[model samples]
Target: MKIKDRVIELLSDKYCGLLPIKSIHEEDTIIDIGFDSLRFMEFVVLIEEEYHIEFPDDLLDIQSTTTVREVIERLEKEV
Candidate 1:
């Protein structure tokens, strides 16, 4: 699966009332997926678990991430 799609699945599997898949991808903002602080941290944890890597606290700046691709790229670099 595309990393973006996988990210969505990882999130949707954990929560309800997700935006339509099409709508989620129509924009570049991953946070537009209706994620708050708690869910944002959860996404970080999921990325670490899914990729078998760790996201160091100092490396993660949630404010700068706007899309799943951005998130995956950062995590991929870390992994």
Candidate 2:
């Protein structure tokens, strides 16, 4: 699956079960979906494990308004 799809899956599983995975748009911000600091941290860990990558602490400063597409683009650059 594409990174975006996988992200939606992970988010759906851990955070937002009320929304269907397909309903999530890449342009949507994390805050728009109700991701708090704790959930965002969990998401980062999940993404790291799934992609076998260690995200830099600096990257954790990502704003709640950051889009999924933006996050994916950053991750792709890291890879």
Candidate 3:
């Protein structure tokens, strides 16, 4: 699957079950989806496992505020 589609699937399964995938926009940040610090970390780890890549230290700190578009861009690079 495309990175964006996988992301939406992950988010839907792991966090926002009630929110439809169609409602999630690339411009939406993790926090915009109601992810707190704990959920954010869980998601980061999930993505890392899915892609077999550890996120860089710099990216970890700002991830909660990073938009889905930016996340997809970074994930594409990592993968």
Candidate 4:
């Protein structure tokens, strides 16, 4: 699947439908979807494992400001 689709799928799985998938916008921040630090870490791990690519540590630092579109773009470059 495409990176955006996979990202959305992962987000949906993690959030358990708390936010409708159709309502997710590219500009939404991770925290906007209720992703606390721990949950964000877990999601990052899933993404790394799924794509076999490790994101830089800096990503964790800036995760609060990171958007869905940014994540998908980064994953596209890595994968």
lDDT of candidate 2 over 1-79, digit per residue (tens): 8776676887774453335677667788867766767777888888788788998676686586787678777777776
lDDT of 1 by residue, 1-79 (tens): 7665676676564443256555555345666677666667777777778878776675455564566566656555665
lDDT of 3 by residue, 1-79 (tens): 9988998777664454335687778898867866666666777788878888887666675555688788778778778
Each prediction's Cα lDDT score? 0.62, 0.72, 0.73, 0.74
Off by over 4 Å in 3: 13-18, 63-65
Superposed by TM-score, candidate 1 places the C-alpha of residue 50 at a distance from the truth, in angstroms, of 1.4
Candidate 4 per-residue lDDT, tens place, 1-79, comes to 7789878878764443246677677899877876777777777888778888887666765456888788778778878
Candidate 2: 10-residue stretch with minimal lDDT: 11-20
Off by over 4 Å in 1: 13-17, 56-59
- Candidate whose lDDT is highest: 4
TM-score of each: 0.62, 0.77, 0.78, 0.81
Q: Candidate 4 versus the native: TM-score?
A: 0.81
Candidate with maximal TM-score: 4
Instruction: Find the number of clashing residue pairs for candidate 2.
Output: 0
List pairs with backbone clashes in candidate 2.
none
- Give the C-alpha miss distance for residue 59 in model 3, angstroms: 2.2
